[model samples]
Target: MISRTLETTLNALALYAIAAVLGVAFFDQLVNGELPCPLCLLQRAGFLLLAIGPVLAVARGPRAAWYGVTILAGLAGAGFATRQILLHIAPGDAGYGAPFLGLHFYTWAFVVFVVAIAASALMLILRQPDGEATDEVQAGAASGDALGRIGILLVILMAAANVLSTTLECGFATCPDDPVTYQLLTPSGS
Candidate 1:
């Protein structure tokens, strides 16, 4: 029972951390008016993907399969970020969008993905199997704690915001390689 509670708490914290990263990305997009490139969107998707495992763990108890999902998402996200970083590797290239804290969003994404992967791996290593499953331990996860619930809600909200923003920016067409304005919002004659 204790271990289960600990796991749930940890999952809640992970969810909050992931949500914060998503929140920062969203804030930058809105406040700076810098549209996300395709790769940037992919990285955001990766972050959402990474959150799934923890969300499941909080809602349905920790499972190895869920952690595996997180690890895979982290790997995919890191690869996307790496591709973007490589694109701007040339000495004189100005880099994509703008730098946040002296590093591009992709760079920060890469770092976050690495840290998430490591943390998931550590959680997997530390998780303890229930010796004799009590009803409380078995069913407790269904009633996730308040913190976990809040974290889950925040992530969901972020996902919805991303979808709305992306639709506005790209419309139904492929997003431009270097988007200067919201395609759907712009005058058709412009």
Candidate 2:
């Protein structure tokens, strides 16, 4: 039987984990000069979507509906990552972007999404019966603790960065299938 406070704390931790993944992806993009492919963008979007439930759970007391959102988003993200993996599975084909820790980002994304789904399911199964929130949970939710607030802010910042980067990379045009440069940053004649 998980207390509301514990549940909220877990949700905040999940947000932190998601933000870490996004942070690494953003760092790789900027530092490594690796432009994300369309599939990679979709995978990132999936991760952002996965954060929605945790954000809501932290802001409001834990709810089954919120976890459901996380599960659905994780499934979508896993699918996108799988698609990218399969695309490069052919013999002699080099995968997109550089491999990190011997596995491509897409493969890592798939792993993260799966783990999130499993964790959300376990959380749902262990949640307190009748959606009851203890006094502590209610107070925490109302006041918003520092750790949870910081986690939420981090995810929000990462999401904003992703939006700005994607807009610069693709502009108003469709993202190039194999993006090598930022569309909006490059001269039209060049």
Find the candidate with the highest TM-score and give its number.
Answer: 2
Best candidate according to lDDT = 2
What range of 10 consecutive residues in model 2 has the weakest lDDT sum? 134-143
CA deviation > 4 Å runs, candidate 1: 130-143
lDDT of 2 by residue, 37-58 (tens): 8999999999999999999988
| Cα lDDT listed for each candidate | 0.86, 0.90
Question: lDDT of candidate 2 vs native?
Answer: 0.90
Which tens-of-lDDT digit does each residue in 77-107 have in candidate 1? 9999999999999999999988889998999
- Lowest lDDT 10-residue stretch of candidate 1: 130-139
**lDDT of model 1 at position 15:** 89
Per-candidate TM equals 0.92, 0.94
**What is the Cα-based TM-score of model 1?**
0.92
